[model samples]
Target: MLKTVSGTGLDNLWDDAKASGMTESDKLLYRSNLLGSDKRVTNYGGGNTSAKVMETDPLTGAEVEVLWVKGSGGDIGTIDKSGFATLYMEKLEALKGLYRGPEHEDEMVGYLPHCTYDLNPRAASIDTPLHAYVPKKHVDHVHPDAIIAIAASTNSKELTQKIFGDEIGWLPWKKPGYELGLWLEDFCRKNPEAKGVVLESHGLFTWADDAKECYELTLDTINRAIAWFEEQTEGVAPFGGAAHPTLPEAERRRVAAALMPAIRGMISEDSHKVGHFDDQDAVLDFVGATDMPRLAALGTSCPDHFLRTKIRPLVVDFDPANPDIDGTLDRLRGMIEDYRADYAAYYERCKHDDSPAMRDPNAVVYLVPGVGMITFAKDKATARISGEFYVNAINVMRGSDAVSEYQGLPEQEAFDIEYWLLEEAKLQRMPKPKSLAGRIAIVTGGAGGIGMATAERYLSEGACAVLADIDAEALGKAKEALVQRYGRDMVRSVEMNVTSEEAVAAAYADMAVEFGGVDIVVSNAGIASSAKVEDTTLELWNKNMSILSTGYFLVAREAFRVLKAQGIGGSMVFVASKNGLAASPGASAYCTAKASEIHLARCLALEGAPEGIRVNVVNPDAVLRGSKIWTGEWLDQRAATYGTDKEGLEEMYRDRSLLKRSVLPEDIAEACYFFAADTSAKSTGNILNVDAGNVQAFTR
Candidate 1:
């Protein structure tokens, strides 16, 4: 229940760090603060931190640089420059290819050279590969108690959806190291604009050009997550009742010593242990009375802590005669087996490959009936942090009834992540796609109108365009135009009736095979009808609804399906007329259909937001120059109805807006580009007006 620390002193710290110069002491202090922040967020040794330094190379006797990351076995808060394991970036990327091969997991086991000093004695963090993957100057990864408390709950995905929208990407839990690095590498390539990433059941990561920005973003991200959780649950409540009466200091020491070895084995670290407990009398009484199994199950919030603490711990009831040592050990081992079996089943259902799983569980908490709780870590600092995360999660769950029931990615998906060939290929092959390159974009009704304009804009922005239209010939001509500008390989023409579900599904299946997946969809296939309310036939109304309302849903649904399958962030844009906001004479069918599209955008925006798929609507006024709806006959009929000459009628429509001008198709195209780019990363369900300042009678 502890909120994030304030940012009041952060700017001052940045300035001080910048002005003080990089003295040995200053560097050590900065590293300490970085590590401390990470541990506070995640469990003991459950997170990683790194700093980049520019030092001359000893081998070549030239000015070569290297990244010095946190070495294995060192606590973040206590580590010095000597504690870092340095690696050349070129060498690290080279390792990706060797590590990705199926046999490399088992074959590549020898220690790789890190830095010049203590090369044989120290090892790098397991997350080194990921740190290498990012091009940022600095990186920090942590499993904040507040975030994990939320991520561990069954409602995590839904709650995250409601909170961060489609901007934040969520990946199912996977063991850290090479495989996890590859998964993240692929994600970063796909979402080049993302601020950070949340690893479900794992932790969070934030990186930037500088250390200060990275740190502040981390705090802000976690605080936003906490705020979202609070908003959903109304408020957070305190955890279980008070602690049990205290025990002798010697007895506590003895218990901690017994647990230390197991923790050391998990983390492969040799360190000291420390213990603390709630002083509340109520908490003491409750812990003393609660069931041993329930209390122990609440151990560490994430799995990486396993290296610092074992899977489960011993619970002693303070028996004198029958100390129950053998029984307690047997029970603890049994629970570990149960946890492993459950974990294995989850992996089987979620993993896509046959990679070996981690040998240890993240952490364990021992409940000593009346002697209070005993927590263990590879280091005292880690143990303390782990205890805090567990206690906070326990409280939140008890208060929210938000028990941890993970919904892992399906087996194939997990396999894809654990043994991602695509990510490995990216490191070795051609340069990564320009931020938006190779991304498939579908624009409905993309033939000689607003749709064509948006398609052209997407091409200029580097996305491969797939233009769809009911008119096969027009779609073909539009494809030729796009190909002339962006080359034939970057554009495709598809004839589709968006109103037909079968047609939409078939097109998407073909498009998925052709483009790998669809990343951006502009649902702009709409028809306008001009008829008086009394003269509007039922058939005409249904036809308008079919193409405008039903057509939009079909395209969006299919787009979401494809994006979710690809496990990538996607964007969708719905085109609604200004008349949808205000009634117009002789256009009931068109107005109602457009209004439906607007409402549909809001609903889909909320539903798709969690999956990193953004949905937005653009309301455009009359722009009929290139449209069939603005034919000479149509204009003459409208002019007669309005009792004005054709020129006067056009002037009236243009003058109705505050800008006193007509909105071009290019104007709407620009709005679509904004919604499609990184600039609108946090926007969804927003109604952007492309109208020349026309006031609506009623606003949503």
Candidate 2:
């Protein structure tokens, strides 16, 4: 029986009781999840798992073999049964007759749908043939770093023989497709006694007649490789003994914060990009190494790593001995331009007659010594994942360099895989990006009802948000809810008192590091009061002004500075109130401060117009539901001043509006969304009344 201890090197998680009632397909999923759960086994979405199981044919009452394989673009770690593409095993075998040669292999992907079993809609991956042709009941193809390190070494085949002997074989490099599938089949036929084979500069492939055996063999193969590398390279200095020292954690983060936004701006000419910062020990070791530049320039060997991280990463010009941020920033634009030119040249040299058009030429991964690794992508998750893949590449390089000379995939081969027509089709099939896609937002008072709603709305539309609020407890709850709905990649939180200039500036700096830079700013931190002119104390008057009026200024001022630094014109939405435009009786302090917010936005709009920054205002009235202010003394004071109970106040406000409709937090959120979105790009310096038709507050 295999031990089932956690954190003790890939524990076999299969249980007899758990597997007792599971079908073959269920066992396959269980096995795949276990293997995928560990990065030591496979990187995310860098593997394929398959099982050939007998199933009753839908049309005929006879049993037929069905090949269930993980679908294209699905991660093994998170895949469900639906994520598997089921194809008829007999039909998949028949595709061998249609294959003309290696030149027409991509066309085989189109034929996979015709072999679908039981009308499964999940699209079969390009690797379907690799699994189908392997003559085994179950197969696992994983790009474990431990295995790839051996595969990417200069003496890969000899090392494979030395490490696993006859149990595992090695195949020469070939791009994955129908032709490579045939190679795998032929190799297996000649080496029937072998449990697996390592594809040169690719990954590991292990198979067995039983699902559990196949899973265990894969684990055993990887574990052997891991143990071999540890023994062979024990105490050997990695990457030439790390040429530079890593900066202190705090200093590293501060450097990342300074550099990320500037790099984001330079690369965002085509479209805005989000960023991810990784300063893991592995990354630090690689970026600070003497061999980092040489290995990075050679690029990644595995197709999975190459595809996600691009051909190579850009090494920033920063010396850890003498940190010069300004000098780095000054040279940044030239470095980026040179990368683009080199990429365009690569595309020109490698383009086939039918290759897809060159993609965004900017490097996905950026390495800064002493700082960390920064990755910019179309979204936060992609940015972070790109960083993770590069780290995997770093590990592979470390092992291979210590043992034998590390070798990346030849440039033409890497380009062919990157620009493959099948891969291009998959990219083209992706759904259109949302309106606010790639944009980053910072919402003040983000723990409150309207603020949370606005953050959710932004996140739903594909914008990453930094939730800022003075109340840490409420901020935590708000972040948890948003992270649950939109994912942690899209939501970040910071405790901020908008009244303090230092806090506001620090929040923006944090935002810059967390998500590149800000594209939208929602100034919604507020307070409410209903004191008469005679009853209003100096303290009460100043409190209202400090929060409502001064807070908006501080937040907007910081936003302007960051936006200017990014050189990407941004949007600022101030959540003022109906009292800003229409005077309210017995609310002298509150109304005055609200009025100040409106004029400030107007002035900002004028100053920001030349720089393409737009300033707008959202006026919400009597938003009682879920409002933090409404749950406290303000609700009672407003109810008493209006001669109605708290419950009756909402109804009274609703009846008083021209539309006679009550406004909720969502209603205000929608108006804020409009100003933040490009829909209001031409309509800045505008006040959008979300008060359900209050004529007194109408902008017209």
Model-by-model lDDT, in order? Answer: 0.62, 0.91
Model 1: per-residue lDDT, tens digit, 1-700? 2223421222223455462667432453474455454333554445667655565566676654466677765656556666677776666666765664533553332324633322434566566776767666677777665566556566776655666666566776665666777777788888878766777756777777666666667767776766555555454222333334444544543433333332222222222222333323323443554333454454433554432333334454453223444455435545445655755564466544544543333334545554445564322334455555545444333423433343322334444443344333333455543445545688998995898999988888667788889998878888898888887656777889998888898677555433435678999997777788898899999999999999998999888776665445678999888887888888889899999999999999999988888999898887766665566555775777678886787687788788899888899999999898878989999888877887773364
Candidate 1 lDDT score at position 68: 65
Superposed model 1: Cα runs more than 4 Å off:
1-20, 23-32, 35-39, 52-54, 61-65, 100-103, 106-111, 114-121, 230-295, 298-301, 314-364, 369-371, 375-700
TM, every model = 0.43, 0.98
Determine which window of 10 residues in candidate 2 has minimal summed lDDT.
Answer: 1-10
